[model samples]
Target: MTNQGFPRGLRILTAGEYRHVFEHASFRIHGKGLLALATPNDLGHVRVGLVFSKKNVRRAVDRNRLKRLTRESVRLRQQWLPSVDIVVLSRKGVHEIDSETLARQLHGMWRRLEKDVKRQPEHQQ
Candidate 1:
């Protein structure tokens, strides 16, 4: 059986890594309660970072729930994503939404990001 866990390589762990995407975002995918900013990477695979501030999520448990859901969504769909670094930002009131709705929103954003990348092949190096 293949490993089905979130690996460290698929994560943007350092502050500089997150800043790289924030400073040079190639695509911005917007959802109801979330925003994903992406910048190209040469790693030939997708990497993701999630931002769920206390001001936005308000509760530790809610932040963890959102982070878990986001990570699962990314891990499952990583194969379909472009070679880029993505930072997912949570908006205020995001914790109020149900898991299904949040998942759906994330799915749409991923699809949108794929389409946007395809549309701008020149963006990729």
Candidate 2:
């Protein structure tokens, strides 16, 4: 899947999508941030979106930095992740972390998400 820049496309925007992420998806937290994901039924490719609010990170620069870091992290790990629409929300600590640290944390989070998905029972036809 290609990297659909964070806010440009039809992503998890509504309350319903957010609720689905919170209720149905499995999550994993890391030092840099938290990743919440749900695998879509379609057997296509993966797509990702980032949620770095100005409220959480006051400065525009900081928000953009965090989004860039998250996008890069997701791009690098895209191959391993399942075909799903993943939404990544940044925590306060993400602003305090460096890019390298963020990358590491993201890698760990990705692995955990994958494990969580694997543990779920496969669908029966």
lDDT (Cα atoms) of all candidates against the true structure: 0.91, 0.65
* Lowest lDDT block of 10, candidate 1: 116-125
User: In model 2, which runs have C-alpha deviations exceeding 4 angstroms?
Assistant: 1-23, 28-31, 39-43
lDDT of 1 by residue, 16-124 (tens): 9999999999899988888899998999999999999998888999999999999999998988889999999999889999999999988999999999998986835
Q: Please tell me which predicted candidate would have the highest lDDT against the true structure.
A: 1
**Worst window of 10 by summed lDDT in candidate 2:** 3-12
TM-scores of all models? 0.94, 0.73
What would the TM-score be for candidate 1 when compared with the true structure?
0.94
Model 1 stretches astray by more than 4 angstroms: 1-3, 123-125
What number of clashing residue pairs does each candidate have, in the order they appear? 0, 0
lDDT (Cα, tens digit) per residue for candidate 2, span 4-123: 343433345576766665665644444445545554535455566667777677788988887777777766666677666677876665687777877777787778767766776667
